[model samples]
Structures are given as C-alpha cells and as structure tokens.
Target: MYEVVLVDDDVIVTQFLKRYIPWEEHGFKVVASFQDSHSALEYLLENTYDVLVTDIGMPKLNGIELIEQLKKSKSNSYHIILSCHDEFRYAQQAFKLEVFDYILKETMEETNIIALLGRLKEKLDQEQFTRNQHLKVTKFLERNNMTLKSKFIEKLMKEQNITKDGWWKEQEELLKLNFSDKYFTPILCFIDRYQEAINHYENETSLQFSINNLLEEIFTAKDQQDVQIFFTQGKFLILLPMKYNTREKTKHQIEAILKELHETIYAGFEVSITSVIGELNVKEQSLLESMRILLKNKEQRFYYKYNSIQNFYPISYTRDSIFQDYVEISQTIKELILKDKKDQILECISQQLKQIREKKYSPDSIKDWAIKLIIDIKLSLHALNHFERQSVVITIADQVIQYVETFEHLEYVLADICEKFLEQIRSTNLTTRNEDILKAQKFVQTHIGAKISLKDVAAHLHLNSSYFSRMYKKETGEGFVEYVTKTKMTKAIELLEHSTKSIEQIAFELGFENKSYFSKTFKKYFGMTPGDYKYKTKEKMN
Candidate 1:
C-alpha cells in the first residue's frame, strides 16, 4: 500500500479528506492528518510517506514550502497540491516542484482523487519493476565479468609465451590486469582429498565454483591485488602482486594469506587444501614460468601431509625401486588373501603403504608398484584356484592406481581393491560348498582318465557352455581348465605311486601328446620333473 499524508490548516478539510476519501479502497493509507502545516512537515520529515496532499494557502509553512523542503531533502513522494481560486499562483510553484497533480479545495471530488491515486500506484509499480530488472541485469553482468576473468587467467597460465602485442593490451585493459612488468608471487593450491570432494560436490564445475567464490570473498580487500585462477586437475593458482619489496617479506605475506584461505575454506566448505607458493617474479612471462614451477612442484604435494602450506620445492626422484620389495609384499598379501584374513590383509597393506610413504617415493613409482602388485596378486591367487583370472579388479587396476593423487587416497583405493579380493575369496569359498560345484567336481574325478573340456562337462550337466563356464568359475573360484589340470596331476601322482607304468605311458593315458610337455606340466605343478619325482620316490622306498 502507498502511504499518504494530508496537510491542511483547516480541521474540516482534513477531517473530510481522511474520512471520505476511501483511501484503503484505492490502495492508499492516510497515515497522518494535520490541521497545522508545521506539525505535518515535522511528521513528514521524520517518517516515510508515498503521497502528500496539502493546502497551499496556510500560514507559516504552506503546502508549497513543505513540498519544497521535501524536494530539498530528496524525498521521492508524489505531491498533490490543495488550492483555492486565489492560490492559482501557488499551483505554478507546485508544478516547478514536479507535483503529480493539483486539486482545488472548492471543487474537490472523491472520484477525481481515487483516479489520481490509481494512476500514482501504477507509476510506483512500474518504477519498482524497472528497478528490479536493473538489479538483475547488474548481477548478471558482474557474474559474467568474473567468468570472463577466470577464463582469461586460465588461458594465460596455459600459454607458453605471452606477447605484449595489441591484442594482449586490449585484453589487459578489458580484464583490468595491471601485471605489465610488475613483479608478483604465484601460488598453487591443490584441493586435498579431491576424489572424495568430487563425490561431495557431484562434479568438477561445482567444486571449482565453490572454491572460486570463497577465494573472491577472502581476497577482495582493497589492499590486496591477488588474482586467483582455477587450473585443471583440482589445482588453483594465485598471482599475488608484490606488496613487500623483498622476497622474504613477500613470501611471508603469501604464506599468511594462504593460511587464512586454507582455514576459511576448511571452515566453510569442510574441505582442505594444500598450497605451494612460488617465488616472486615479474611480467606475464615470468608468471608463466612461475606457474610452471608451481605445477612442477605440485608433485611434491603427493608426499605432503593433508592441508599443508609450503614454500615451492622441486621433487627429487629416488634411485631405489619401490618394487625391490615387490616379491615379499606380493607373497605376504597373497597369503593373507588366501587365508581370508581381511583385517590382517588391510593392516599388512597399511604397514607397507606407511613404509612407502616414509621413503618419499615418487608418485609414478608408487603407482607402478601398486599396479604391478595388484595384477600379480590377482594372477597368483588365480593360479592357486582362489580367484578368477579375468576379474574386474584386475582389468581396471592400472587405470585406478594411475589416477590416485595422494597416498591417503591411494590407501583407500588399495583397501577397496583388497575388499574386492576378499569378496572374491569369500565367493570362492561359498562356491566350493555349492552342490552343483560338488557335482561338477565329481564329474571331473569320474572322467579323470579322458581329456575333459569345459564344454563337454557343461553339456553333460545340461547347462549352456558359456553360462556353465561362468557359473563354474564364479562358484568354485577357478576356471574349468585349472580344475581339470589339478585333477589330472593328482591322478598322475596316484598312477605313478601304485602302478608300474612308465612316465610316457602315464602321460599318454592322461591325454598328454608328448612326454616332454607332460614332464614340463608335472614340474610346474609339483616343483619337479616326473623322473626326479619317481627317483625320489624309489629312493625313499629302498
């Protein structure tokens, strides 16, 4: 509702206007009515009103004086002058003050006043709508400007060489960048626990937006000209103008700002960041080099404790291979996995990871060790008839390990893989208890004298060849080929111990085409050639 005030130095006129105008019906509220212009002006000066109706021929301060005083005070109220026939000259003065309309006291009508109020309400509504639209446009332009600045900075960081040509100058002016030849400090920020943070944010853009907003709020001080640029891979760069002349002071300043930033982000977003502040340098080229240094030193973050702030330092690659202990680590983990000691396996993994972390091994080396270890464990367990050969974890181990950015995250990923391994182990154990698996094993033992195939056994059981093969592996944890090979080897041992058959005859009977191939298979399975095994047996007998 538009509030209104009536100021006439006649009690009858003020009473009639207040009681008969139907102010509420016309969306106007007569908040004040005065028989003295001075008191009305005092009330108007202290309070707020949207419309003013006042008599011009009063003593001391008339309606003209009140309107003039309001105009001088920059009041936006719409004014309607109440005048008599002799006060026509006062209407001219009211017009100069931009009064909405004039009303003659002798000929005032309720319909005319209501109509004027309606028009005034429309004007106010239109102005409000225009103001809202202007505000929205302003906000949109500001947001767009920030986006353009971020994109420009991102491009500048990626460019190998920056030329100070016409286009560069144009962009500098457009983006309000003052880094022509001024020395500035570059700092790199890494979002720690990025994999988990990404899951929290649901995507990269949201996480970037949130961090950028926080940076803006923290760096918007008048004394600071620090520009934050979001680089790829959960990394952001800060270009701080040289406020302090010496390198030490500038470094100290950058460190303090980063500490605040780290605390602020963690407090607001529940996320931590690792910051690497580069040395002070001059110009865009220097900045480009500085950025490269910051990014190069980002590798050092892999070994950093979570949410650490550090001066830039190059990463030193170790000459010792992380894989030198590969055999020991792999064998230990494989044994734990086979034993289905999930907690022990995880603890063993944690101990080894801690050792790797303490060594400060390069990220690539750690990843290489992890990938090879996971694959080797899968293969070895499969050979032991404890896991499937083509498991999902085996297929994606390289990709998963290579993408791990931090040792903490790497540990989580390794634990997940181990959990899957235990799942496979438990699955295999459950399958060995399956009645169908036992029946399949019986079929294999009963047909041990013949060369058996997965399809042949699958057909005898009236199951799909492909489906049976899959179910068999999923249930028993070993492929049909391995099961058959082990069964045949056990049978070969029985025949050699009990019957007087030559190794070649036993090999032919067990479906080996050549004695050498059979002996090689026997050596691989039993860790000795058939002749060595038989000779050892005969010597034991003597």
Candidate 2:
C-alpha cells in the first residue's frame, strides 16, 4: 500500500486529506502530515512514505528550503510540490532537483492526485509480492531448523515424557486449549518406519515434498472429513470426531482407515493416526485440564504402539484418589523402563496399585492407576519395541496388562515380572552365563571344518564333559549330539541350494564323518536328502 505524508504547516490541509480522501480505496495510507518542514524532515529521517505533498512557502522552514535540504540529504523522497506562484526560479530549481511532476497549491486537483497514486500502487504491489516470498523462505528455513533438529527431538521427548505416561496430562494443563466442548477428538499420528519411508527422497527439498504429499493424502482420504490435522513439531496431531456409538468401535474404524491408507496407498510407513475423544461430561473448569490429555492421551497413542484399536473412555477413567494413584503408578512404571528394569516394571505397577486399594483408595482409583500403568508401558514400548523382542517374561507382563480385570489377571503377571527383575538384579554372573552360551554357539558355528565333538568343546572351555553337555542342553533345549547334527544339516541345506559343493565335499566341510551319515541326518531334518530338499526349494521358488 502507498503511504503519503503532506507538509504545509497548514492544519486545515492535513485535516482535509485525512478526512475527505478515500485513501484506503486508493490503496494508500496517509499516516501523518507535518505542520512544519523542520518536523517533516525529522519525520522523513525516521519514517518512510511513498509521496510528499509540500507547499513552496511555509513557516520557520519554507517549502523551497525544505526541498533543498531533503535533496542535499540524498533522501529518496518522490516529492510533489504545491506552489501558490508559478515562478521560473522554483520550476527551474525543482526540475534540477528531480522533484516528481510538481503540482499547484492554488488549486489542488483530484485527478492529478489519483493518477499519481495509481502509479504508486504498481510499485507497492511488486513490493508486497517480494515481501511475501521472503517470508515463505524464512518459514521454510525455520521449520527445518538445521542445527536445532536435535532440539526438536529433545523437546518432543520431553513433551511426551518418553519416561512418564502422564506427560499428556501436563501438556493439557499447560496448553489451556479449550475446545468449547466442540465435538472434537485429538489425533496422534506418526510416520511408521520413518527412516525408511523417505529413503527415495534424499534431497532436503525433495524429502520435504514427499513428507508433505503424504500429509496431504491423509486429509484427502475418503473418510477424513471432519478431521483437522496439525503438527506440533514432527508428530501429527489429528482431530476426528467419534463417529461410532462406542469408543472401541470408533477406534477400530479410525485404525482401519489409517492402516488402509498407509499400507495400501503408500509403499512406506503407514503414517499412523490415532483419535482420543474428549470427556463428554467434564466440567467447563476442567476444559483446559482435559484439553491436552484428551488429545494426546494413551487412548490415541495406544493404537500406534499396540497396533490394536482400543477405545479408552478417558472421561470414565477419571476418579478421586484414583487420579493420584494413576499419576504415581505412571511415574514408577516409567522409572522401570528407563533403568531397563523390565521385570519389576510389572511388579511395581501391580503392587503399587494394590497398595492404593488396600489403603482404602477407591476401586475407581485402582482402575485409573492401572490404566495409567498401561499407558506408561505403552509409551516406553514405543521407544523399546515389544517385550518378546526384549524377552518372553516382558511379553507375559504386557499380556497381563491387556487382560487384567480380576485377581487371576493380577496373578498372571506377578511371578514373571517380580521373579525376572529379582533374578536379574540379584545375580552377578549374568553376563558370564550369557557369554558362555553365546561362545558355545559361536564355536560350533565357526568350527564346522573340523571334527568338533561335545567332549572336545568341553575340554576347550575347561569344563567337565557331563556338566558342559547339560549346560548346552539347558541353554539350547537340545542335547549336544542332536544340536550339532541339526546345525550341520541346516548348513548342508544352505550349501546344497546356493553352492555347487558335491555331497562328499559338503559332508566333509560340515564335519560329518561320512557322506552316508550326513545324508541320514539331512533326511531326518528335511524329510529329504540334501539333493531332494534343494530341488523342492528351487521348484517352489520357480
């Protein structure tokens, strides 16, 4: 927009332009006009305007002197002179000064002013476009935050409390986002296998476009109406209203849609989406309190971690001492996950909740605390994959949480969680025992060229043959003879399928005493000789 500053030391003229002119319609801003040239020059030094309407004669500083001073200062003022007299000296001097097309103050015409402003409008338009482009570039750079990428990760970890499950509660209480009970549900969506998803787009600009396109596809999906998506940082925030009767049903529907879009439409990660509904009966005072919780709650994130659709009645989960119990349980469970104390994590959760109940804490409190415990573990699992990926004991502990509803449910996980943690913490030869088994497996694997026997292996490890055999069986669930024979035959199959090694050569390489014995073991394991197994596998592949 073009802005004009008039200098006449005439209040009447300034007032006339301010009130009568349709400056806004003409794409102009008449910010302020000076009553004297001294003040006008000072204002010019401090501010900028597209045009200046100055009379040739004024008070302490006349128009001609001001114009001379303005030009002497090398100012970029597109001056428009307003003179009462049409004098030769003034016109000659103004022409030399490059004063843009002078005007007469004796009778100021609307046509001249309007035409001048129209020309100024073109310049302003170009300036605005350039400014907008600059702003967009700035935003893009800020979003990338080259050096601060780690900062983003740190903040997000802190926000979600990679340790605590109630980080959402803190966020909800802190952000003060009141939705006016608008039928809104918060969505927690993230890229699945993020590292591999954008492998094709190695360039920064290209990768950004790919990520952005994926986001666009989410909104355009068939069932994505009534969904408002935002990204607080890297993680997507989805707001989809509950469209089904029960929370469970709605969760299933949301998961299905997110899964189909991610799995079918894209070859990469699903860009997982989750939805948590607001408490329908929460007091308005608690509106802000529940805002972040309802949005980022375990209910929403659970779908991402569990890969299951679960309806969490966050509204129903809130109770008296239960709230406090949930908070404490969540804290303790988080402490376990970080310390890598897998077993006690479960025992700690169950025992703490039990104590709350014994202390006359409401059953509702136990339930809420239990829910918090589940949520805590879920968030940690997001960091540390499944417990089976970690261990069977952890897997069992997790299994109990899902099915925990009665005393039997509580008992199901107790022994496993408590026993494992106790065993791990109390033991000192943990690494040595693990290393021994691993060393045995490695020795057997690498020594296939020689006639390696259990007695030979025991002698190498400086252990008695009987105890060594038993330890091997206990560790691998197979007797030494059986395990060695199985390993040799398995390696024989690989060689048969992918190598040109003859039967005799393969038997010798696998430490088999003879080809006939190798063939026997191979047949027992594969129900076929090495030759027949290779042929069948090749046929199946074809």
Candidate 3:
C-alpha cells in the first residue's frame, strides 16, 4: 500500500483531514499528520512517503517550501497543495514545484481528493511496471552478450592464423577483447576427474558455467590484462599476455595465479585442475601453433598427478619386439573372449597397449591397430551369432576410433570396448537359456490338467524322447516323469484347499486315473493323507 503524509498549520484542518480523508479507500494510508510544517519537514527527512498533502500558506515553512526541500533531497513523492487563498502567486508557485494538484481549502471535497489520489496510484503503478520491464531486458542482454563473447573466443581459437588485421581490429573493438600485446602464452587447464564432476553436477553445462565464473572472478581480481578464457571440448584455454620488459616476472606471476586457481578449485568444489603452460614467446602469427603445443602438453598429464604444472617435452619412443607378434596378440584376444575369460581379456588389452606405447608408434599406426583389433573381435561375435545386427559393434568401434588421440586415451577406449563386448556375450547367453527354458515351462504350465508324457512332449518339440528327457532334467533339475508327477500333485493340493471336489473328482481333474494312487502320492509329498490335511486346516481356521 502507498503511504501519505499531511501537513497543515491549522490544527482543526489537519485533524479533519486525518479523520475524514478516506485515504485507504483510494489506495493510500495516512501514516503521519502534522499541524507544524517544521515537524513535517523533519518527518519527511527520515521517512519516505508515496504522497504528500500540505497547506500552501504557513508561517515558517509552506507547502511550496516543503516540496522544494523534498525535491532537493531527491524524494520521489507526489505532492498536492491545499490553501484557503486562491492567489495567483500560490498556484503559480505550486505549479512551478510540479505539484500534482492544487485545491482551495474552502472548496475542498473528499470526492475530488479521492479522484486525485486514484490518478496518482495509477501513475505509480505504471512507473513500477516500466522499471521491472527495464530490469528484465537488461539482464537478458547481459546473458546474450556473454554468450556471443564466448562464441567469438571459440572461433578465434579455431582459426588457423589470427593476426591484427582490419577485421581482427574491428572484432577487438566490438567484443572488447585486447589482443594487441607483443607476447602471448597459452595455458591449458583440465578439470581432474571431469566425468565424476559431471555426474556430481548432473549437468555438464552448469559445471562448466561454474568453472568459467570462478576463472573470470580470479582474473578480474588480479587485474590481469589482455587475457581471454574459453572452454573447448571440456577443457579451459587461457591466453595470457606478457610484457617484454618483465618476462620473467610475468612468468612467475602466471605460475602464482595458476597455483591459486588450483587451491581455490579444491577448496570450493573439492576438485583439482592440471594446468600446462606453453612457450612465452607466442606472437599473433604463432597463436595457433601455441594452442597446439599447449594441447600436446596436456597429453603429458597422463604421467603426472592432479594440480601439476609442467613444460612440454618430447616423448622418446623405442620400438618393442611385441609389435611383430600383433597377429598372435589378436588371436589371443579372440580366444580369451570366446572362452569368457573377462579378466584375461582386460589383461591382454593392457599388455598390448603397454607394448605399443613402448614401441612409440605414431598415433596413426596405433589407431589403425586398435581399429583392426576392434573389427576382429566384432567379427568373432558375429561368427558365433552372439549379436544379431553388426551396426551396434560398428558404432562402438567408431566411438573408440574417434576418441583415440593419445596412447593412454586409446587404452581407455579399448578397455571400454572389451567390457561392452563381455556384457553383450553374457546377455546373449542369458537370452539363449531363457528362450529354451521359458518355452518348455510355458508348455508344461498351460497343459497342467492333461495326461502329458515325455514322448508326447518330445514329439511336439521334434526331438527324441531320451534326449528331451535328459535335457529337461539338466535344465530344471528334475526328471521328465518326476516333473509331471510333481505338477499333478501341486494341482491336486490346490483343489483340496480351495475347491469342494471329491477325492475321485480331484484325482480325475489332475489327470490321475486312480484316486487311491493320488492320495498315496499326496501323502508322500505332504507326509499326511489329503482328508486329514484338509480337516486339520479347517480346524485351525475355526
């Protein structure tokens, strides 16, 4: 609700206005009423009001003087003037002060005052709505600006050569990026256990956003200049500028910043990041090369722990004799898979990767070998009819190949593929057993009241009775005759419990010709005659 304050030098007028104004009915509440303009000015100094009503003619301070003071203090209240005099000077002064309304005290009416208050309320409401709309538009533009900046940084990084040309200068001005520095250094920052972080956040975009925000805060706090941070393929790339005069000093400063970044991440998010710094002599022409070098240094991360900072060094490769036994390794992997030796298959893949890494083969050669091994395993599964369609295997193989950048990454992919293949084989074995056992179980369950024999079932299945009997026993742990007799006894017990059938009728319903034989079998199974069992059960119920 809007608040209003009334000021008048006449006590009677002030009292009447306070008691009879119906301010609340017009969307306002009279919070204060004063017979002294001085006290009213003092109240206005400390409190805020949505509307102010005061008499124009006063001793020390008039309505015009009070509004002028309010305007000087930047109070945004609507003012209405009340006076007994209809002098031109008073109305002119009120008009000059931007008074919302001028009324003569002798002609004042409650209805007119209420109508004016209503218009003031509408104006306030419109202003509030406009302010809210402006705030929303501002926030939207800020978010869009950030998005566009990120895209521009991504594009700049991907470009092969980035020079300070005309177009580059235009972009620099538009995006507010400062890239005219003499020397540039690239730092590659990778979140440790990135997949676990994703799982914890349950959303990759939110995690990335949080990390970016932290980086931006750190950089801004340190007053780092000519720096750009962007994310690509789950890693952060920061381009830091260095001055020629303080190259060593700048390098040490960057190292300190990286250390702080690592500690802050661990403290805040319980995660560590590994940062690799590239050469500090990178110029505009060599930005792409610097990026490549920094990324290559990220490969060395496999050898170190989290929160390590290191420079790039060439990996020394020595050929191993195991590469000559590629065919034997392939055959061994196939044999292990077929034998369902899960642990041995993983061990073989690990050993092969170790040999390949030691051989220091080119990335292309390693990828080729890995692809071939994946294909051979897939073909073996197909030959055994373990998988119905080849598309699934091909898709997995393509993923492995697509992600094979480093030797360590290749090993991870191959291990994952081996695990998937093991799962497929296990599922296939389970499905085969279910298909056979479920069919037989369904047949027996559906024909429970029929006088079915082993030969009859075998004929229906197109198998010899002897073989079918042995298979059923092996699968269900019961001989064919034993199974059929057990099924009939189970049905006979249900009839005795829930049905009012006579013993002879129950026996006939269960495919038992002789009632005496059925009772004997029931006694053997339950250690009691059917009549005695039923009578005891009824007694317990009573």
TM-score of each: 0.58, 0.31, 0.47
Worst 10 residues of 1 by lDDT: 383-392
Best by TM-score: 1
Residue 503, model 1: lDDT of 93
Could you give me the TM-score of model 2 versus the true structure?
Answer: 0.31
Q: Score candidate 1 by lDDT.
A: 0.77
Query: Which pairs of residues collide in candidate 2?
Result: 9-35, 187-238, 322-365
- Each model's lDDT comes to 0.77, 0.57, 0.73
Question: For residues 258-367, what per-residue lDDT tens digits would candidate 1 score against the true structure?
Answer: 88888999998999998877777556677778777777566778777679888777866776757665655665786677667889888988899999887778888888
Worst lDDT run of 10 residues, candidate 3, spans 383-392
Best by lDDT: 1
Model 3: clashing residue pairs?
none
lDDT at position 479, candidate 2: 81
lDDT value, residue 383 of candidate 2:
27
Clashes of 3: 0
Residues 132-181 of candidate 3: C-alpha lDDT, one tens digit per residue: 99987975665455566667766665676666678788877876777556
What pairs collide in candidate 1?
none
The Cα RMSD in angstroms, rounded to one decimal, for candidate 3 relative to the true structure is 20.6
